[model samples]
Target: MTRPRRRVKLARIVNERKRKAALKRRKKALIKSLNTICVLCGAEACMVICDRTNNQGTHNKMVWPSKEQAEAMMSRFKSLPQEQREKKAVSNEMFLQSLLAKKSKKLESLRAKNNQMEMEEILHNFAIDPTSIEPATGKLTRLFLYINDLIAKIEENESMSQSATNVNLV
Candidate 1:
């Protein structure tokens, strides 16, 4: 049986020789995978790796399917309209903004639901024993306002239902 692979730490390798060797092996594997995917899906694919500055202060690059194919693909991409090119682009800032908005909306929704539940519980308790919450002036005012709001909603719903019934009878 094949042994399971151990999880590798997602950190930069400190040893220069080991790091470069691993990079070479991994780059080859990546290009192989890209070729396999293209062959299986009948799709054009390219991979580029821009290495960090070496001791000589020179950068190196690795490109799959030759430099010519990658350049053609890049040029084709550049020819597209600006809007079309960035239609579904998600940078870190954009992603975080969207996430923040979603979380804020959800938080607001939860707060409203919690307030509704708390008001309902208070109303139930007050109905069971009116003297239990009489000591708090602020709570009493809030409870009164909540009750008024509930009454208004109930009346609105009843009027709409009655109007619908009348319309059906006509």
Candidate 2:
């Protein structure tokens, strides 16, 4: 008979091998699922589903009749595999556009920062003493600053919206 220590070592090795094999099987299963195989019964050529219903052939089949039943089924499950999630397969055009939109947002923010800095420099250069303040001149400058700030905000929002637009990434 094997020594206890040797038997324990052998068991650990066997368990490790089983774990590795199971992981490999799981990877293959996920790949197969992404290719439209059903998760429940491993049925290929079946309806693509966000999550598989009980061992039923119809992948998207609901176990319960009403919303409560559906919610209960979903809540009972701990989690679904990433492949089983309803993630829209990534699209090339959307990916590229999102990349460009991110770039545009960065550029826009940089430009706004530079503009604000320049305005601050100009304001500092055209400094007026508070003690000798001209009411009319101060009011006119305040009005111009408010308008410029509003225009900047509008431009900022437009650039921000561009990023949102390319998100067909679902």
- Quantify all predictions' global Cα lDDT against the true fold: 0.90, 0.59
TM-score versus the correct structure, for each prediction:
0.58, 0.29
Model 1: CA > 4 A from native: 1-70, 135-137, 166-170
- Across 14-125, the per-residue lDDT of candidate 1 in tens digits comes to 9999998989998888888888999999988788899998788988877888899999998998899999989988999999999999999999999989988988888899
> What's the lDDT of the predicted structure labeled candidate 2?
0.59
Which of the numbered candidates is closest to the native, going by highest lDDT? Answer: 1
C-alpha RMSD values across all candidates: 5.1, 19.1
lDDT of candidate 2 over 75-150, digit per residue (tens):
5442766666536656798889999999999999999888667656545644754444355656547646856887
Spell out the clash pairs found in candidate 2: none
The CA lDDT at 8 in model 2 is 26
